[model samples]
Target chain A: MRRPMPVLAAGQVHEVHGEGDDRAAGLAFALGLGTANRQGAVLVVRGALRQGLGLYGEGLARLGIDPARLLLVEARDAAALLRAGLEGARCPGLALVLLESEGPLKGYDLTASRRFVLAAERTQTPLVLLRHAARPQPSAAHTRWQVASAPSLPLEAPPGAQVRPPGLPMIAVEALRWRGGPAGQTWHLQWDEQHGGFRDTTGSLGGTPNRNENARTAPSGAVLPMAALRTG
Target chain B: MAVERDAARHGLAPGMTLADARARCPDLATLPHDPAADAALLTHLAKAMHALTPSVTPDPPDGLLLDISGCAHFFGSEAKMVAKATEITGLSTIHALAGNPAAARALARHGTPAQRRAEDVAALPVSALDLGEAATTALRRAGLKRLGDLVTRPAPTLAARFGEGLVLRLRQVMGDVAAPLAPQPVQAPIRAEARFAEPIARTDDVLEVAEDLLRQVAAQMEQRRLGGRHFALTLHRSDGARRRLLVETGQPTRDPPLVVRLLRERIDSLADPIDPGFGFDAITLSVKRADPLDARQTGLDQSEETQDSLQALIDRLGVRLGQDAVLRLAPADRHMPEAAQVSLPAAELNSSVSFHLPAMPRPLLLFDPPQGIEVIAGVPDGPPLRLRWRGAVHEVIHAEGPERIAPEWWRQRGGHMGEGATRTTRDYYRIEDARGRRLWVFRRGLYDGMENAPSWYVHGLFP
Candidate 1:
């Protein structure tokens, strides 16, 4: 007998079809299992750059996580990224799966994307993709966003400063479509090298406000307190 | 005086001195006597008596006791046994055996000093019974010089007179109390002797002699269902020269061909300037140790992939150089690198290695320990970045971790070696070189200022 598929908390399934619009940056706050607060899996695109990943690692670090997990792939192209990302299914202890690549991704087939969506839902590892804006996105992505931004400030400066170090990156994210959130969530986050993640005190007024009340208590002073961050 | 000493040759009187004997025989010569030499020769006879049994204990380098109950069968009869004793004693020493030790001792000192019987011993004087001088004097005063007079004496009267042991000795001689002499069980040694019609002269001839000896050796072992692990091959040169070659094998084997082959390699190389003068009269091959060959029963498809090939290689190397040059890594109860292994005869080593372990991971490449390597790094905690090992600089390209393994503490403590070398804590790191060579090195001891912690050594290399 086929077992009944489990119901997502109160049936919060989006069943999103295709990329509808990116006008207000479709913003959504997913209050599910954050990578830090609990044990889970997440998927990110290869070469998603600092914008999407910076916020992701920050949100994870903020959750006072039990143990955070990420499945990483350093692949040559989109096809290679997909192949590598699929290997994550073999890890029984897989918590969060992230896929990153820097190659052109403007021409992916939507028909295959639908299958990727179903596989993600079945495996329970929510897929996060960081692809080029020109790439034809698969119609299967539950939520689509054009992630772009900059660091809030340099290690020695506050936000909106030009004196930032050369290697430090910035991220500006706008959700193209969010199932449960406004389409225009934008957060200004700076990368904390010591924490090995990104942080944004600017609030998730537009996109996902994933951090709970406990995260806001972390000290964020003029000098980026490099504590509370670790990477393997 | 000399004239009278010469006349004594005709018939000398009882009270005579040496000056009178010289007067009677001025031409007669006398030599100083040696009683010790006689006693020593008697001792050697007792040793040769060991042919009878290992229990041939000498009664103070003179007397010999044989428990001949079982020994008599070897000579056919008691009369034959006495004949054998007579043959062995020849013209050298007096020998006798009776039911009792006192009877035997008395018969040995007198009564032709060669052979005697129980009834003839019964007719000897009462002194022949080994009575004390005082007792014999007392017996003579009573006019009882011969043992025949006391043969029918009243038992109570003799007991009251002679006080126990004399009566007991007489009774034991008559088979009253059993006098048991425990014989040492002599192991009939498994032996193989080859009598060469022609003594081996050339070194190669020794090989043939070894082959012949091996056949006899294997047959002896097969009869006993035993296998020899150690064998000594002896070449009896016609010139009375003896050269021995010792051959040892791993498993107990009775394969004559392999045994001959192994002994041949060693024997053929000997630099013996042997002369087949009259040709060696004998070549002996003897096994010193043997065990029952409990070989695993082979299945239908099973074959004895005997380690003969490896053994053959070892023998070849051993012949060219020496036995000490060959070594087999044997497990030993030690953590010290030098003591970690025992080099024993490959054939004699135990197959199963045992260790009492703290279970610290041992390195794959262990030097005779290692000369301490000077390291410059974040001390007390971090892995070394620059290591000076074997007088060469190696920059640690990448490091995985610090697997901290403490020293075995149950053993006696060694001196403070900072962190670890002999008995200090070891913070081991699996470090790789920029050239892709990996090393397992440890930082000795805590680098705390409390004591000395200046040593670091590269213990092993991991591929």
Candidate 2:
């Protein structure tokens, strides 16, 4: 919380990546933050990977995003995906655009990203490029962040008597790059699925850290934590 | 048989034998007459006259009628315009100026070899009125050989002698009345044109002319409070070939720059680019489809401007790529997962379709044709423990549903036989795999001992 996160600007490109978990949570969070009070729809361009139906509703519900306002476009390749993204970004009725690609996106270079940035800026629609296990590449994006799923706090059960399901999922987020500001600041935040809001667990929870705690407690647990099995 | 001028002078007339003509003049020569060649030459003349005025009608057996009222001034005078028409057609043409089209046609056809006015139409032959054979015969028997002879007779007496049609024709050709002329069909398009003294063979010249024409068209549209959704540019080449390029916008627009940009894109993307061949002599642009567009007062704010820019972008893309390439998802009326939604062309989206969020979580992507899978459920009526898809097995970590959905049995065939009438009842499950991937799996058919064993399919994925 000491290093305040920069606000997502209208008509800017932001890239997000996740490690070893349902990568959708980061996209849901970005979508929720980018499309607040904008009078348009959200378009999701999912490249080659068939993003199944289950996680979207759950993730949007967790992030407090309205499913009715979301539009999904399944593209065939990187080029088509990028075109869909840039076109969606240029649409005035679109409040935000979330793009997810299967592999290293081809032809999405500095020049292409710059064109996307210009279109987004011209239309004042925010664009979020979500990737899974992709290499860091140069782009005209305003910021980039790496989001990894972190362990949630242990559920309340008699410590020596029995273990219960974990409370909520937490994430370790780092701003890898941020334009107009300093980058490389990491924060531990907890996501309230019911209310679809984020909390700074490290700032308010006295920095009780480490995702390994759940793994350590799961082996000897009677009620395995529900959050531990909430991946995918 | 048609005789040449020289042959006619040697005491020879058309329909006479060649032997007789040769006997009359030893040097007489004859050639076969082709009606098709005459028709084709007439058509060429008609097309050539199109440059002078768009309303040009063909009078068969060797004549052309042109409506040159407003356009005559362009060539300096009616006489000069006729001269230009004769030059462009490269034919021996006789033309006359009259207030009515029938008088003009008759005067040109039979009044004289050169220019004739409406007053002179009375001296022409009664046959020139183009009356029926019976009326002309009756007029000839009554010694009314000239239009003057017919006009001098009492109007009622003439009408009683020859039916009302003859009187009507007489009045029409006499310039005392008006007769509507049916010319070649011309769609009334808002258009502008540019003619070059010399033909243009370069793409830049074509684009420049197109830009000017677009400006003119846009101004006209603005004056009419209208916007054009479809535009066409016709390039008339010097070699008589016409090339046309048509561009369509996603929505009505009167912006000249946007129209020119779209035309440029269409020209650049053409697989067979324009080959000026002998160069274009004239270029014309027409607004083929227009819609009434009211003036929009946009505030000097970011949101409205952004919306305008976005609309411009969509129109540009629609011209470059196809309009179908841009799509928006619309909910369908069917209950089946695959039929529950459809992709509609964004430009032509049906706004009345209300979007309904599924009561249960539906997959973001469903297989076009649901892929079959092997399910290993531990219980007879429970979710699968493991599913094999694409030769890969996924161990189910958790399972959610047995949401039963029945087939639309009203449409089932073999209604009378219960054995054949039974349709598969689907049991959908939202399951998580060991690798943390969630899947939508469905069991088809039932194990009620009245049918075959059930099958499974992987329907969709969760993002």
Task: Indicate which candidate wins on TM-score.
Answer: 2
Per-residue C-alpha lDDT of model 2 across residues A108-154, encoded as one tens digit per residue: 89999999899998878888888877886999999888765554554
Can you write out model 1's per-residue Cα lDDT over A6-92, one digit (the tens) per residue? 111211112211121110011111212123232443333244232211212222222222112222233434554564454342222
CA-RMSD of model 1: 26.1
Per-residue lDDT of B268-364 in model 2, one digit per residue for the tens?
7677988899899999999988989988887977777755655565565555556765556666666576766666655666252545545676654
Listed in order, the DockQ scores are: 0.01, 0.12
Off by over 4 Å in 1: A1-232, B1-184, B192-200, B268-281, B293-299, B303-344, B354-362, B413-423
Grade the docking of candidate 1.
incorrect
TM-score of chain A of each: 0.48, 0.80
Q: Under the 3 Å rule for N, CA and C atoms, how many clashes does model 1 have?
A: 54
Candidate 1 lDDT, B1-463, residue by residue in tens: 2223445456555466767765765665555446688678667666566665466545654567765646877778877776676567564455677766556666776565433755355666777756689887887898877665776787678779976766665655545566555444454676778775655455567667667777777787888788887788776766777767777765677877777766665555456644556566677888988989754555553123323433443444344335553344444565443355454543334352433332332333244455588887754567777888757797765554467766555454443433344436667765654433445677767666665654777765432
Clash list (residue pairs), candidate 2: A52-B461, A52-B462, A53-B363, A53-B364, A53-B461, A53-B462, A54-B462
